[model samples]
Target: MLQIDLWKRVLIWALVLCGLALAMPNLFYSRVETHNDAVKAIAASGGVASPDQTAEAAEWPSFLPSGLVNLGLDLRGGAHLLAEVQVSDVYADRMDGLWPEVRDTLRAERATIGTIRRVDSAPDELRVQVGEPAQIAQAVALVRDLARPIVSLTGVGASDIDVSAEGADVVVRLSEAEKQATDTRTMQQSLEIIRRRVDEVGTREPTIQRQGEDRVLIQVPGIGSADELKELIGTTARLTFQPVVGRTTDGSADPGARNLLLPSLDNPGEYYIIEDRTVVSGEELTDAQPAFDQNGRPAVNFRFNPAGARKFGTYTAENIGSPFAIVLDSEVISAPVIQSHIAGGSGIITGNFDVEESTQLAVLLRAGALPAKMTFLEERTIGPELGADSIAAGKIACIVAFSAVLIFMALSYGFFGMVANLALIINVGLIFGLLSLIGATLTLPGIAGIVLTIGMAVDANVLVYERIREELKTSKGPARAIELGYERALSAILDANVTTFIIATILFIMGSGPVRGFAVTLALGILTSVFTSIYLTRLFIVMWFERRRPKTIEV
Candidate 1:
């Protein structure tokens, strides 16, 4: 009964060997990490590695597994930021876009709704006053027809916009369901753009995720500070081309109803009145790079997609000799006259830009624009010195806990206890091996979970050994007593570990950040401990029994 099947024996040994092999890289973490990064960089560069990079990549053997457990912020230091997206900004932009369509629809029925005039209203509302009060109902109905069914899962059968009439004025706003859908899209886009921006900088293991309907939580390990992280992602980088109506020195100049007056970036106090409708938005841009102008001044070169190129070429041809303003986040970066038909859909933006500004602009343009503005609600920078201290403290705690558990087990059960201690050592190794194989993050709380696991690794052996002692008082032989002990202990061992694993799973699902990290290590440790204690320790004892067939044994 104590004999393991041949297949089972092979499986157990193979699992252990594979786990150790996968986790071996962590023993030389720095070297392995460098090799991995170098390999990635060379691959990205079309497999052409520099001499230094090739030498660094050769430090680790090609056949060995290179995966290492990622270190968490508390163990590696980084920047953390909680930002709330202004979803209302998108609502206002949607309302602005709806105005042209509303005007066209109303103009076709001018005899019925009278002369409709756009009126100033709330940012989220599109308001229009009708000259004929009697036709207000018809006007509302016509605007309501503009509403399309929302295609989102949660917004099924709901209209995208709600149309209501306030006296002679028809007001339009996004429906509640549409607003919810918009918020979800905004958060998703923000998360993706943030990830792209952070990844472009090559920061290792940056966490960019949405916290709620309108908030994002970003953590970047090995980054300098929260401010630096914010600077990298904060700029909206909204570039637009609008026809310049007029130029003035007065900031208070009213540039008519459909024009906006923005101050020039290069010239202080100088302002330009530009058309509100963008000729081509940066969303159509496909590429942006920093390059020197013909005069050797820093500038940004941009290329547009096909549709954008066609529109830009047509606009440039029609508006030749007129100045067009390049606006970035409400500031007029430059105003240049259309000299030619610019058919290729490529152009240069020249400003009083330094080399760094041009480079940053290019990076922002390449990463695309954020869907909405974000207000940082919380920010913190964790120092590497604190992380180092945490690592040292965690190591000391693990060593002390491990030593105490080892001594206690050896004293309690003698030679059998020593076999369990050996299994315990391998148990810890298996924990690290699984963690490395899975690429789980190691945090301070995770370290505590592993230490706790070390203390509990011999639990199954304790149960079986105590049962053996109980059986020895009976008339059973040593081999029969041992087999019966293991058989009787199996059910209790399964029940305890299963229940504990369920709790760990719940923690991982419900908790955030460090708690999840702790749950991961705890769950993995429980699995590894059960395997080593029941199977590996039993195999050791069986081998000892075969080697020395004694009639009686000491408990």
Candidate 2:
């Protein structure tokens, strides 16, 4: 009556062994983590590992599972920042770029519109005043023709730009559909750039996610402070090459409508008036690195893509003796005269830069520019000492709960209680094993979930033991009593755990951060508890029954 099939027996033992094996790595977490990092470094470096790294990797066997549960920001201490992207900034930039196009289109219809002049308006609005009011309709129609349909699922057939006329002035702005599309793309690009910048520092698992339409939440574990992280991502890094018109000491110089007056990076009070039209943009850069100039000064070397190279080469060849300004975020970094017809798409940017500035500049150039400026709304730093205290407290709570549950089970049903205790222990191991295998982050709340699980795990064993006691009073054989006990308890165990598991699943799907962590451990605990109680405990009981051959015994 208490017999288990060979396949079932083997399966039970296999699962137990695998769980133990997986959980073993957590006991040697530091060693395993070091091994894992070394392996990753070596792989990233194309198998060229340092002697120390090779030694560290060799300390842990290659055959063993090296996965470890990642510690959360709360437990590892990190920087947290919530930034809001200024999506409207991109709108202004887009409008500024459209000026050249709008001017060209209106000039083609110069006979109708008369004189067309750009007027100052809101940052998001593009206003153009025409001398001839009668031709306003023609001007609006021409501007509207430039509008392309928004390329998005929700905004299909909607125009990218909206053109309207108020008397002789034509007003243009990005349509609502285009704004939505631009916001989505901007947020996605911001997230990617932020991730790349953070990853470049080699910080472990960082949580960089979009909070809402314009906000991004960044949490980097093991980071010193929020300021450090902000410094890394806050730079706009907008690099442009413009034809320089003249240099002046006047900060308030009006450099005409088509020119921009930008301050020099090295020289205070010096400004350079440069043409607004860009010869080359940083977006066309394929690679950038920190290197030394011909004079051995720290500088940033850059290589342009083919299209950028062609444009830059042609511009340089045409304006051989004229100075071109290298502008970074509206600051004139340099205005070097074209010495000769420079070709091949390669150039060096030399400023009054030290080694550190050059390196940071290089990193920013390589990561690409943010689509929009970000204003940090919230910033926080978690200290490692606090995390240590939390971990210590969590460990104490777990040990206390575990000891209490084990003692209660032992006192209630004697030998059967001991069997339940063994299963409970294995269940805990299985929970850790599964967590490690899946690389789930464990938080303080997750520790609480495991503690709660320890108390709940004994419920199945109690049900079986009580049922067995009742069957024994009815004069059923010990083996037969035990068999019926498990059979009767199966439905109750499944129903109760399934309902709880469903709740845990819902929590996991809907919840974020710590709540998800709790749900993970809770769900895993439920599964492991069921397996150990039904199969593992029964196996032990069956083995005992066969060995003793007792006619009557206590559960």
Candidate 3:
């Protein structure tokens, strides 16, 4: 009788929680039912296609993504990649591959550059030492065109490796500021490239970022082909256009070409001459989409920016029927002749291509060309062999853990033990409901969190059972003892659940990925256990006592 009032209160609490569970699908979520109906209708044979006209489809707009907890990468197999960036290529491009050319031109002038070699590491910077034996002043004066870092200046006979070139060579030797900048730029460029490649191949929601300076971090949510991805992403498809060498000044085209030349549109073959400029650049193109031309041949449709359009219009206007090479990575794709003025800034490129070849070309062109070419630094892959084994091991561990807890509760408290186990099952249900409601991701460690919960959930039942036995020792009636049991155990149960909850909350805040998963399951279990133990188990106890009203109680 002393604890009957408390039992009533906890029974009411359970009822209230049941009501909250009913409202959860609407409170935290809305319109899920409508979306499901619409998707079902769409799957049917005579479904309405219009989202507006279809009653079911009209409700599709309010639907949220399934906010269910997803098993994480460790439980589910996926690929992870770490890559390094090489930025020395940027400086090398800036030099325009003229190290040997510049050296030869200087030598022809009879300038005695003492020593000439490209920096072994930087490779972009050429170190030149002048003076027959070592005349630094003479060397500097002779090579005024070359930028200076006259490392060992010579007045008359100063002979000590006078490395006078762009200080970029010395920058490599210093190895702090220069290396950092190179690493930063390389990572930035590589991230951009990787993101594009991921998009091209239809990999969804990829995360690409600079990890430190030289390394790139890439996370792809649902991609499978690690090897294919590595090959695609690692290719630094750098494209370049070198002005084709030919025809001279004085209104003269190459022999058998004067008829092909016409007046330029912007240049009029005059001031600001189109002839001075390279005909086309990849930078001008906005997008390249695969398509078939009027003749049913595979082609890539291209759109150019206003400036590129003007450059292109003038080139086509001047060289009415002359062919221009479309070079990709120095290999010519097509050297199509100018057919029309192409004034609208959009046109198509036709070649001997099939649909697949044409589509890939368009994808690459849309991704944009890399600034500098790259070589593959490294590659690694994880096979599914190990992940499958881990899944099996985790399943066995969960079954053993659940069995242990179930037996312990049944042996420890007779009929009350059975009720506690029933409450535990409902407790697990609430955890899943909460997870589905909140979109938390599940993981391997999360399975541990749930398994640990089985043993812990029995603690409240043990507290109540022990309290009943103590009251019974005083020769109290079974009903009176049961009521007193709940009353005495309430404070300790609250305090224990509250403390565990705080720890789980803290874990959720501080951890990432699998750790966060563990926190989620642990925290949710604390809440559900509190509900089921106090309310569901209490309801069973109250009914059991009211019906049996036994003269003697068995512990």
Instruction: Assess candidate 3 and give its lDDT.
Output: 0.62
Q: What TM-score against the true fold does each predicted structure earn? A: 0.83, 0.83, 0.55
Ordering by TM-score: 2, 1, 3
For every model shown, the clashing-pair count is 0, 0, 4
Ten residues in sequence with the least summed lDDT for candidate 1: 1-10
Give the runs in model 3 whose Cα sits over 4 Å from its true position: 1-82, 91-121, 124-178, 188-196, 199-213, 216-225, 239-328, 334-381, 413-443, 453-555
lDDT of 2 by residue, 118-231 (tens): 999999999999989999999999999999888999899899999999988999999999999999999999999999889876677788889978999998887899999999
- Model 3 earns a TM-score of 0.55
Better of 2 and 3 by TM-score: 2
After TM-score superposition, the amount by which residue 228's alpha carbon in candidate 2 deviates from its true location, in angstroms, is: 1.7
The C-alpha lDDT values of all candidates are: 0.90, 0.90, 0.62
Stretches > 4 Å off in candidate 1: 5-7, 152-154, 209-213, 239-367
Error of 2 at 323 (Å): 10
When 2 and 3 are scored with lDDT, the better candidate is: 2
How accurate locally is residue 536 in candidate 3, as Cα lDDT from 0 to 100?
68
